[model samples]
Target: MSGLRVIPTWRHGREWLYVCGEDGGTVAWYDREADRVSLLDEARGGDALEALRPFLVGSVAVGPPPVPTPAELAGLALHPDDDLAPNRPGEHLAVALDRDPGPPRRLRADPRRRALAAQQRVGEVLDGLEAAGWRVLHAVPLPGGTYVHHLVIGPGGLYALHTVPARGRRVRVADPFVTIGRAEPQPLLRRARADASRCSYALTAEVHPALVLVTPSSAVPPAPHLFTDTTLPTLARTGGHLKPADVEALHMLARDRGTWTRA
Candidate 1:
């Protein structure tokens, strides 16, 4: 107890403070959002409470950790290698760039780099929604070499998002086609919808498709399925489709890499 320490950590956008013993083992943890302190070593409860006194905001429930839900148990049983929960926004692209970064002196910036930037930007906004009862999975791989940019689950339902880099460019959408700046139009919406369909088939739930534009100068027509980085957080304000437990179960399933092998 002489070397007790309080260490802070973040997960799913929630803050947790762990009280550690002299041997660097967690004796207790304080969940700030839940307003609870769970003791791993009941004998050290006094030391843990003392270490966390400076960080506690108000009166909090102090006791043993709650029993794990079915989803939590499943997630805990998953092997790290087969878990997609740790993936960043542009996980595949990040790995590719790390392995073979291409010519350093190219005349133009790599398009993959632009796409990765867009994904990361959108991912930040989605990650922030975790506090609002939303769960997001990034870079979900499919049967082929393709991937869904991001999969979101919440009270608003599920969505498969595809990110488009339109920094400072006008965007036009006509059903399946999307035109950006002076570039030729592409059927990006169709691809997004297809990805959502695949996700639905894999998860046995209706997954909506959305095309997310990053920093677009302007997006015309304002379709329901079209979103910008600035407007994406609005999804968190939507509810009525699922409860907390359903969201957790879907998230646990979505984070398992094996769940997408047949999609």
Candidate 2:
């Protein structure tokens, strides 16, 4: 928000919406009531509304989660470019809400102790990303689906994870978000080799840049819109702050102090 114009408004309901733009490049909307913000930009992402916390804007204003509203889902734009490769570009509606959640949740439903096959599939991608100098912070299952994995690539590389299930019988999870359609391969414009998986193939057209290769399964649904724009690099994004206590303790130890005690 320092130089960006993020539009925050309300629809005809209990929801609040927000969208962003810089120098009026494009108009986006954030609707808290509908749990989503629409950007007039080119890229599309699901769960888009969750990122609009006041903190992200460097705003010290503390408040409650806004409500959802009834707006023209098709008119609200959330991106600046229309050529959001790897994802369908245009104004679309998602279940973006002001649903304040706890945190990155880990749900273990089955006691059978099954591992995520996507791990293997994603491992290849992570290896590629890391080999290409992308530091992965963490990976998690998307809320609306399973085949999709959310890999937190440092400072700003938060991308939608994907993989085609290896001829598996079933999806371990209930509802994994997904969207399946023919896509054209996009060239490696970023200075990388062009490759493709069995299910997720890279062609000339970049359909969903957010796409990833995951083991196919019924645990998730096909989510067509899931993306976000990031400023921080993968390494910087995953970097955490130093602990004050730890730093202080180290100082005392350096001075030949045994243990710390309060006077």
Candidate 3:
């Protein structure tokens, strides 16, 4: 793999420098230190990769652009399911023009869309955490077609967070489960617990499972519920004795596509 290229992106909270191959849909991401790389797919893998190169190798540096607000991202024509094509100016124009080319389409209330929306909702929360020394990853697809919404690390600790759609509803956790307007908590709690366990085993750390509910008119108790406007003081309480190095390690492991995707 002599001509492999990658683009640097920041999403959910962490920086991802990855390559979406020209043909294979294979992905590989570099660690923060740039000393290591992990491939997401092995079916089209190679052991003799050359020195990695940035997608914008010769781009001229201009003044830094202003930070984008959530509104801007909302208006942008992008989504988690969109393909990350190779770096070429007009490469995507054909695909874009071939698309519906009309107003964006709204998806039905299906499991996949729910998961994607939950990931987006949690992304808004992670955006605020950057200043607080937090790092997060979103939409991590695991085995069996399941997705982990947000994996967060900060001064408080490591968390496997899931955003539950509970708009206009008051949600409460009654030990080992959550309750939202007559909805049973066991299913949600069980899934969250299993996801946390999987994340913990993957990162070799004790990951805590938490819920992020979307409610505009209710005050979430200062517990596992992480509202977009409130501080999750309890979530990243003390880093769980995790140091910066540990956090980076976990981030790299979680970012590795192979960690979640099976060969």
Candidate 4:
């Protein structure tokens, strides 16, 4: 019961509740209004309210993960004009929270909810990369309530990757911008670059900027103009520039709490 937690999540932009064990186990997804829970195996066959009653009675965060709080976000001097400024849709809520610095904002339309798919995609890719001798980290917290989704250290080189969820859609990347279906090109390369700089300083190593676009239905192949294609296999195969010791050093730095939380 101590490890039980309920955090806000979404399935395709719709409110979907997520429950998991802090000690690590299969995550359970719920839909309170629908009265259902989604199994890890993609099957749907459980009573959400019934299964979650015990946990919910005494514990539920109902917001973003605990790593970065609103007060924490406020401490960082992330001015509006700063490159690391919360400019995109993803950064707004955290920045807003910083100004107000109160209890976790209500669950309605949490911006972090939108990054769930990207996190899952990045997690899958990083899992494979870890299995294949790559050192990786995910959901790395930084100042200003922002998070570094994925960081890879291996022979290919150190990479700070930002995930773009473009699944089941045609994605075309044309430098500083990416077009997904009819949507306008949302430029996130700068975000990735800023993340890399932060990682570089944290690990005291040069980090490369990269973007992973999760597209299962892209008719066009990845090109340099699109930035490096960051599929699971692509990430697992490339970036072999770090040695074992170097990788260890980076892992050590990444795990060090001061590397990120410090101003």
Per-residue alpha-carbon lDDT of candidate 3 for residues 1-263, written as tens digits (9 for 90 to 100): 44555556663344555555544343455544434455544442352133344322333222222354543223122322342211122222223445634445645444444444545555665667766567677666677866676777766677887677665766776656767767676467677788989888776778888777755346766655344324443354455466665555556556665666541
Instruction: List candidate 4 segments past 4 Å from native.
Output: 1-114, 220-230
lDDT of 2 by residue, 80-178 (tens): 232111111110101111233224454743211122333443443454443332333122211223222333232232233333332334332212233
lDDT by candidate, in order shown: 0.88, 0.29, 0.55, 0.56
- Highest TM-score scorer: 1
Against the true structure, what is each candidate's TM-score?
Answer: 0.79, 0.21, 0.57, 0.54
What RMSD, rounded to one decimal, does every model reach? 5.3, 21.0, 11.5, 13.7
Task: Report the lDDT of model 4 for residue 157.
Answer: 74
lDDT (0-100) at residue 138 of candidate 4? 62
Instruction: Tell me how far the alpha carbon of residue 177 in candidate 4 is from the true structure, in angstroms, after superposition.
Output: 1.3
Model 3 lDDT on a 0 to 1 scale: 0.55
Model 1 per-residue lDDT tens digits across residues 1-263: 45788766545677777776656566788999999999878988888899899999989999998897999668646655677877889999999999989999999999999999999999999988998999888999998899999999999999999999998999988778999999999999999999999999999999999999999997545667989999898898899999999999999999989999878
Candidate 3 TM-score, true structure as reference: 0.57
The window of 10 residues in a row where model 3 has the poorest summed lDDT is 83-92
lDDT of 1 at 20: 67
Error of 1 at 205 (Å): 0.3
